[model samples]
Target: MNNMRISPAVISKLCCLPAFYFFMFCSLAAYGDDSALNIELKLLQVLNLDAENDQQKMLGISSIRFLPSADPSKGNLILLSDDTGAVENAYGIFETPHTFDVAIECNNHVDGEVCQYEENYTRDDLHYPPLFTEAGLNQDQIDSNNLWCSMFYVGSFFIDSSPVCESDIEGIELLSGGQERLVMEEQVVGFTFSTPAVLHLDAQNFVTHKYTFPFSIFGFKRNWSNQNTQKTGVRPNGGFEGIALLPGEEGLYAAVTEFPLMQDAHLNRFVLFSLEESGNRMEDKVMIREHYSYNVDKVLPEGAAVVKPGYPKTGVSDILAVHNKRRSFITIERTAIRYINRSISSVNKLFLINLPDSSDQFSSSELPTMSVIKKEIPIDSDVMNNYNIEGLTWGPELAGGNKTLIMVNDNDAGRASQLTKIFIFEVVNL
Candidate 1:
């Protein structure tokens, strides 16, 4: 006798609001399939960060992140930029973003609304040559691809105090996890960018130090792990383009080869790195942990008309590890196809990667191609217009459950045809 009778008025109201009674009327609504990876995005707002007008701040943006704040409204946003100016590696930290224009959706995704950042600190080449050269990095290597950052936080808490991007911390430290170089053979070899630069900023955003927290070759410096890339290596400027801190795992991080190691050109390799400290914090090291493989898709579907003969230029640009989940991540696979005199066509799609729960779950022998990674395209090309999207991060949360996924594009060192852009959208299950 749990008899709860609903009045006609109540029933009428519930009927009028289908969404309000969705769970109660499950039989009438389409059920969700857990097997399928389904993610939906609703465009909420878009803005630009150029109100400050610094070319390095506006031009070659790579990744964006929020330095933790205790108060819901006080968090600071930091944007990493490439060495487009050849002056120094730079990034900007700003207060909450407020100014913007109205956003409009295009054929693929929403585009619009100019927003600017109220900068609190602009850190660039504060201590360039020393920080980089300590790990044997040269000037050219330091400037190429630096300062694409992804904060390692678990629900406002830092994974560890290694860099102090947390609420109660005083200083800020970030990794230049953008593209590095890969070399083959020996001395007559090409440049090898197997290291991620470390930039330390004091409380007021003044540069304190700069250096490389290096990754290696056969567990040695300047080598890009045991991938033995010496046979056939990553394309120029195509090494370690994507990086993320593994959620729930402290001091453990992940980086992926921008394109596949030339050996498995069709499959991208994801490598794990862990931080180990010595007596001195500056001398701490990031070493290789594990390796997993993922299959890459064509720039366009099989039957789509393409004007290119080779794979062209395609690879993962940046990675964002899902905060609540242990081993899942958001992978941005992008490609640029240029015609001699035709418009350059691009493919930028977002994929969901759920790595195996345990390292022992699968062996390399099992992978004819070591492409055992579980992947599904949650946001397909059909839903987004083609743009050379380089980076993404979790913006402010909208309803505690839904999050704002902010993505940015690189303007190729300020090219006329390519305008630096930022895109914001409401993401579910992200």
Candidate 2:
């Protein structure tokens, strides 16, 4: 429960009048389905409260994906706090999250603050328990295929002290009976990312250690400063949304969302690193010196609309980047899917970039780019109405080896909107 408090001003920028509310209504509708991994987005759940204990009403869910240390079918669901503040430092303020490990035993089982919506509930009274329901999907519906996957949360949170150091206090605890443990807590160790990114891994089947980074070593680095680092260093133009451990390689790779909040004029970037197990703990993960960056404005110049990045590009920010096994480094843009050709045996590096305009909005038109593929997946207009597309993960493969794309939207915790419309798309060869 690393609660990072945000400023009221920043919170204002993230809020939309009717756009946000529309998305919230659509999101709850998408999650209400009981079965069928339908491409059509439906509300999975909803939260409504207006009383003293409202904070406990709905443990806002952020991202959902399979964890390595558990059954392939069951994954871990993470939620962020509703308080308006920076996400990285929010854990320091309100440290409790309503988290649930998606398991067979917990299927559709309602308990605690999450019961059917009562007419007495309203947002005015600042109620306690929120209302929620299990994902409309069931085991049989999603059991048609066998595959491995994991997802990480990467977003901006106005932070104060240090997220690493303060995560261990009793305040921060996983809500689902502590399924997601507090692996490491530390102060800012050194800013490894221009954008905030979380490392997620699928330990093949089940994993023992769910926490992947060196939180302890980082926490001990007392000199690290969150404010100074963000101002001076490379703050991600697009937030770090996509994360994946490249097979045959050492560490992990992630996609950075769009630049400068929604419009970055610099280079589109992606980070690479290796995760090494140190004496029974996760630590010493080094970032690849040679990273990958592309120009987006140069590619899609057809009046690129205001939108966040998506899977390998989405998350809270825009860019969610990841590699498809031995293929290429896939970078999701606001309008297209761009890939850099790199053989598995080749030294880990970006392959090409022949461009001119270097501004954050500079698209790649004249250069001999690697490979840019446009996506055919139809977006849920309701979810993308206010915030940009946020969550993106290479979904589980089907029974016939065809690949599917699993995407989610950022509810900004429960502050902005809530839509459990996890998009499912089958990749068709272009």
Output the number of the lDDT-best candidate: 1
Positional deviation of residue 32's Cα in model 2 after best superposition, in angstroms: 44
lDDT of 2 by residue, 1-430 (tens): 3323444344324332233333211111112223111122222223322224544333333333333224322233332222322232212344322232332111223663111323332221101111112144244422321101112211122133222111110011221223432211111112232223232222221123323332221122122245443232223222333343444444433333344222223454443444344463333343432233444432221223343343123222222223332423333333333233311110000111111212232222221232222121122333333332333444433334444444444443445444333444444330
Best by TM-score: 1
Candidate 1: clashing pairs of residues: 47-115, 48-115, 108-385, 131-210, 131-211, 181-193, 216-223, 216-225, 217-223
Runs in model 2 deviating more than 4 A are: 1-62, 67-93, 96-99, 103-232, 236-239, 250-252, 255-265, 276-285, 297-383, 396-403, 417-420
lDDT of 1 at 402: 63
Alpha carbon deviation, residue 171, candidate 1 (Å): 19
The sequence of per-residue lDDT tens digits that candidate 1 reaches over residues 1-430 is 3323444355334333332221211011111214433355655444554535553345555555554344332234555544322222233332111112112222232233322344344554322112323234355544432221122110011122211111101011134322121101111012333233333343333333323333232211334445665544444455555557776686666666676654554677776666565665356454556668876656543344555555457777778788776787888888777654455677676777777666543223222434367665334432234566777777654434466677777665354345556676766633
lDDT of 1: 0.46
Backbone steric clashes in candidate 1, count: 9
